[model samples]
Target: MTSRQRSAPASILQGVEALLRPLAVFRADLHRNPELSGQERRTAERLARWLGHAGCEVFTGVGGHGVVARLRNGEGPLVLLRAELDALPVREETGLSYASTVTAARPDGRVVPVAHACGHDIHMTCLAGTAELLAANRASWRGTVLLVGQPAEETLTGAAAMLDDGLYQRFGVPDVALAQHVAPLPAGVVAHAPPGEPLTAAGAELRIVIRGRGGHGGMPHLAVDPVVVAASVVLRLRAMAVQERRPGEHVVVTVGALHAGERANVIPDSAVLEAIVRAPSLAAVDRVVEVARRVVEDECLAARCPDPPEFTVVTRVPAGISDPVAAARVRRAHLAVFGAGRVVEVPQGQASEDFPLFGADGRVPTVYWYVGSVPPAVWDRAPGAGPLEKLHSLPAAHSPKFSPDPVATLRAGITALAAGALAWLGTGPLGNGEIMSFGSLP
Candidate 1:
């Protein structure tokens, strides 16, 4: 590593240490007042205020509460840092002092508890700290940094919304877009996928309606039970992973929600099932969806339902693939900031992200990685002999009990992002003419 790169960590660490306390408070406030997808007005307002204070040109409402903060420093490659602004419809059960106690109604008029079970709060705070640190130390880097606060990520719609609203045309297409997600790994650690592999899986959400004939509880012979059909469909779908999948292929079919009847004695006229399917590629996702449709139809037909089941694909997103050159540069930067022991490579994950949409379908080079969030002590004491075993035992993202160790996670996250931006801006150890060559990648 160059002397400049070796010396950059000290400055980045110093800056992160100075901002840790305030950033923690900011993150806690966001955690306490979480907003659901597509309804992030208050969250956008807070992010805009923070960015404005950091001396960035703030633009709000680009695509349903998406905020863009632009920090221009002389003339260099423009880099975009993205984070999610929406929370999930889950009640907080972590028992932390800043756990969310908020509830909001969905667009369908169904009220549900809200919480940041996915660690978007941590992502936002890290982006905010990175923006502030870049603004404070402009002498170390020379480029335009775009800090994006995206909404509706949980539904896999926010990135597309922003792009359709002219995100790139308005703010200029960046040389590279950078983002990071928190995982259940040990705190103070960072991980990246192999060069050509996908960072996340391709995903689609399916909503199926099974129809039946309702009748009084006393008359058992009159009504066709859609609940029984739905249960059969669920079991069949689960079996597809083992029975239908190829030897080395990975596919996940999850039925997250099922609504059938209000009372046990009265049979409802219909049942609703909400499921999400994920695979490593779009073609695989399509195959799984087709199989799922067939399973549901056959089950309903076997049950002698009054009508065929209804299928609606709510959303579909492509897998997030990192650019080889960009990912290599960022990985080198991460290794420089946090020693070799702290930076490791992981396999492609099952969780899906819409962040790849920001890449404009490979038109722009993009880099995405993961930051460990589990506390070291907790990870060590967990019942497992190795990392993978322990990882499965811990509460993962989307779980109500999932909570990141604030201090260590925030520090590592800020450093990782700042170092990545600097690596592309031609200012850190990974800087110099070699890194700047990425601006010419086709």
Candidate 2:
């Protein structure tokens, strides 16, 4: 590493620290005014406005509220830093002063509460801080920086939506793509999975609708009992991984939702199940899908369903793999900034992310890492405590109650992202007047 690179961490921290307060307030504002997927009109405009003031050439409404801001420095490779712009359809339970009380109307026309249950507010704030640092320290690193504000990530469609609308074609592909997700780890700590290890599993949304005859509650034989069939389907789906998957293969089948009858004494005509299938590989995901289809059909048939069961593949997203080389560089950068004790190893995650689509099919080298969001006091008090008393004490992402320590979490995020970006942008063929290539991929 260059002497300049060795000293870059301190420089980055100094720059980010100055912007921490505004960034925290920005995050709180975002948390207060959460918007749902593809409906991030206000969020996108707010991000664009900030980036524009930071000297970035901003483009709004790229792919239905996706924003792209470019800050070009002379003669170097391009790097993309991405952040999600949408929020989830979850009501706030955190009870914080900035907690979202905002409700948005879904496409189905039902109004529902919205909140940043997944910490996109923090992600966006960090992106803003990074933009500020990079813009201020342009002379320290030479390259084009593209800050992407993506929408609909909660639905796993935003990244693809942006790409389909010509994300790369319009602004050009990036040599390196960087993004960070907030985890439940203690504030100020950053984590990365081992090199070559999978970051997040590929995901497929499975929707099953089981059809049966409806009748009065007293006539048990007449009703066909679609609910029983639905329960059977759920149990079999769980067994799929154990019975079908290889010894070392990883898989998860979660039945997230089920809906059927509304009345207490009446049997419903059909039951619907919404499940998520996750696996380390696309083939495994495909296998799970196939098995799930057969399972639903066979179970319904065994129950003497009046009609064929309905199956729909709602959405499919590819697995996320960290580029070994890029990841190693980012890891080293984290170690430099936070020290060895604060930089920890992260296990492969079961949760799915559409961030991979930004570098779809490995078209761009990407490093997606985690930033700790749990308050230090809480994390410190977890030791010697039971799992339920400790881990369960803090709310996990996706819960309406999930809340990150705003200031510390924001600082940690800005550090990891800006440090990692500088690590890659500071070195390599790009800075030496050569282009970046994934070698075998392109």
Candidate 3:
């Protein structure tokens, strides 16, 4: 890109393409050195370093490894672009040369492999690229651009942590907040869920501990077996989702973790189960929790446990609902850049995000959208192979095999963020009115 002022739409488009190689290099660096939630020290440092170099007034360590970059042009709307800085605990299995072989210690003192299975690496790179583009092309748009590098997104606590630490009060209130996620769609395509449909549901993590009397494994009849109780709870939890929830309403109850005895000859004193519940609405999420609590407690009673099963919620992330006006505007901007054929409608996703928390208790309008990450060749070949071998066969986020095309995905992502920012903070010669057609920029 050029530091010289170029207010034309074509100029901005060209600028985004120019940053692709550099952004890919930065993204690969992140992918190779992944960090876990609440521990994104190195990740945040890298972002802060880049933003500072991009002429942004960078603030480091703003809410547990969070970084905020501010670029003030003159006077206009305050637009905030948020991206996560944390990686998942999943081990990388993609066999990519730059795949993560990093590990970090958890609060429990155990170490686990880390990888950017959920594409936070892409999110960070897009934000960085957008920041650099907007900073360099200062003549196009006028406003304050707040770039947020949020940590612990996998745990859904980063947003809340930043807010509680006075994210807006410290920086400034945003008129609009925007974020884009990289998903398993064909590369160069962007997708959005319209109003009444949301990109992600509210999510809650439930930890249940079932207590029991311990004894030799050979003498199960002599002692209460909490493992049996946990098994019952898991089955009933699934049944609650299948048989209890209201028809036409969707919810998912996944028992992601279950633990009991350590040795074959001994029964543990207590069994633990960690369940993740997701629902489109907050009320539905609460209902699932209620049903789960009832099922677990009742099962414990049936198992004749001496103590009640303890149920504790670790975290809850609200549903991410894109503002109608914001979504429409960004969609139009995306169409202008990538054309109508490249922009597609997407179904509501079951995954959860902490991005809604950036709205500051619904005080700000937020638009969170998705950018397709599947390679063009893979997407084209899927259909010829069979229906089952569709784009869905592409390794989705959170999978150990999730590996996004570096250049294609980053280009599409950077384009979406820059175009969306331009849409809201319209172009100008620092003082004139600029119009955006559906296709052309100037």
Candidate 4:
């Protein structure tokens, strides 16, 4: 995040500063002390504490590490705001003095370092500040506001966990849902897609194996090298797009990982390809799988392998659709708060978010938006920093070097998340309307 001296209306800057100033500490705190999915006890506690102090009823540990708060006034429309509290397995390397020093053991007995490389620290901070700002200034609207501190967003389970915990029925279903993500786009710009473009994309994983015979390295013809077969399989996978599908479709099939042989002299018996399939729509995702399966089989047959290799598709994420009406309200709020130039339009994201679970029934309209995080200075400095790291490299989101500009990122998230909730819930001034509270008074 970068800092800029924009000569704008004092009210807009004041609103953002008031919300973000206290919230920046939360970001630094969360960054210095990260927590992994399903293990956000401390994170949840922090959110609850802040929300509790803000005059809203806060409940801790709703689902795993979920925290809920609720505020009410003369009712008109109920709004739900979600904040993710999970961190990634990134070893902090950004020389930021406040980088994560937290570590924990996983179910598999492996201890991993945690960090907020994806800007969720900013998200969680924004959640608290946004809640506080809206709660404090609740005199301007009429309705109930539900603020949720969700867990497991990295693994795409937080939203589902809360709903499964009877969140909707326990208190009441919200008339609108609002969510946002900090993007790699230029800082201070709020990028939003229209009603239909989903902020939470649907995705699945695939385990594709190619098998062959082992032979001496000296004689090429004597052995059935899966390496060769796998190579052709890769080529075929790329070709499928050019040969079978129409150009410009929203589809993505990527092999994230691969594993095989060990020795220089021996021929490996098998090769494994772990892949991910993504699309804005389920039908497109299905088509991606279909193409992948066909390409694998055809390529293996062409390579004269012993038999068709084993292939499996694992469900990873459901497409996250931002409620259309909820999104519009948010967009309008952003414009009102930041003006037109700062509010940009969003396209369907190739990245996936799991917030779609809210719309699993396809009845509720969910609106998701993107907030730019890259500092204009840093971006202007690192011209090579394209949209994101190229496709798949294990070191991506988990890389220790994955640091984003914080000040700008934090402000963008705080403003967007705060304004999004305010518009959805119709929040009023500090002493006037309903506030952003979570759970039943606990």
- The top-ranked prediction according to TM-score is 1
The TM-score obtained by model 1 is 0.94
Q: In order, what lDDT does every prediction score? A: 0.88, 0.84, 0.84, 0.70
Compose the digit string of candidate 1's lDDT tens values, residues 349-380. 88999998888566789899999999998988
Over 44-142, each residue of candidate 3 has an lDDT whose tens digit, in order, gives 999999999999999988889999999999999899999999998899999999999998897766688999999999999999999988888787778
Better of 1 and 2 by lDDT: 1
Point out where model 4 deviates above 4 Å. 1-16, 19-21, 101-112, 198-200, 207-244, 259-273, 294-312, 316-321, 382-400, 427-442
Per-candidate TM-score against the hidden true structure: 0.94, 0.90, 0.92, 0.77
lDDT at residue 308 of model 2 (Cα atoms): 96
Number of backbone collisions per candidate: 1, 0, 0, 31
Model 1 lDDT, residue 108, Cα: 66
| Ten-residue region with minimum lDDT total, candidate 4 | 433-442
Comparing 1 and 4 on TM-score, the stronger one:
1
In the range 275-332, model 4's lDDT, one tens digit per residue, is 7777767777777788889888887888788867999875567777666665666776
| lDDT of candidate model 4 versus the reference | 0.70
Q: Look at candidate 1 and give me any clashing residue pairs.
A: 5-429
Deviating ranges (above 4 Å) for candidate 2: 1-9, 383-393, 427-442
- Identify the superior model by lDDT, candidate 2 or candidate 4: 2
Task: Encode model 2's per-residue lDDT on 1-442: one tens digit a residue.
Answer: 6776656557756877789888888888888999999899999988999999999999988878999999998878788999999998898899899889999898757698999999999999999998999898876778899999999888888888889999999999898898999988778877777678877889999888999999998897978989889999999999986787777888899998788997978989999898999988878999989988999999998999989999999889988888888887777777767766677665687889888887776778888888888888877676534323455567889998898998889888998888877776764211211111111110
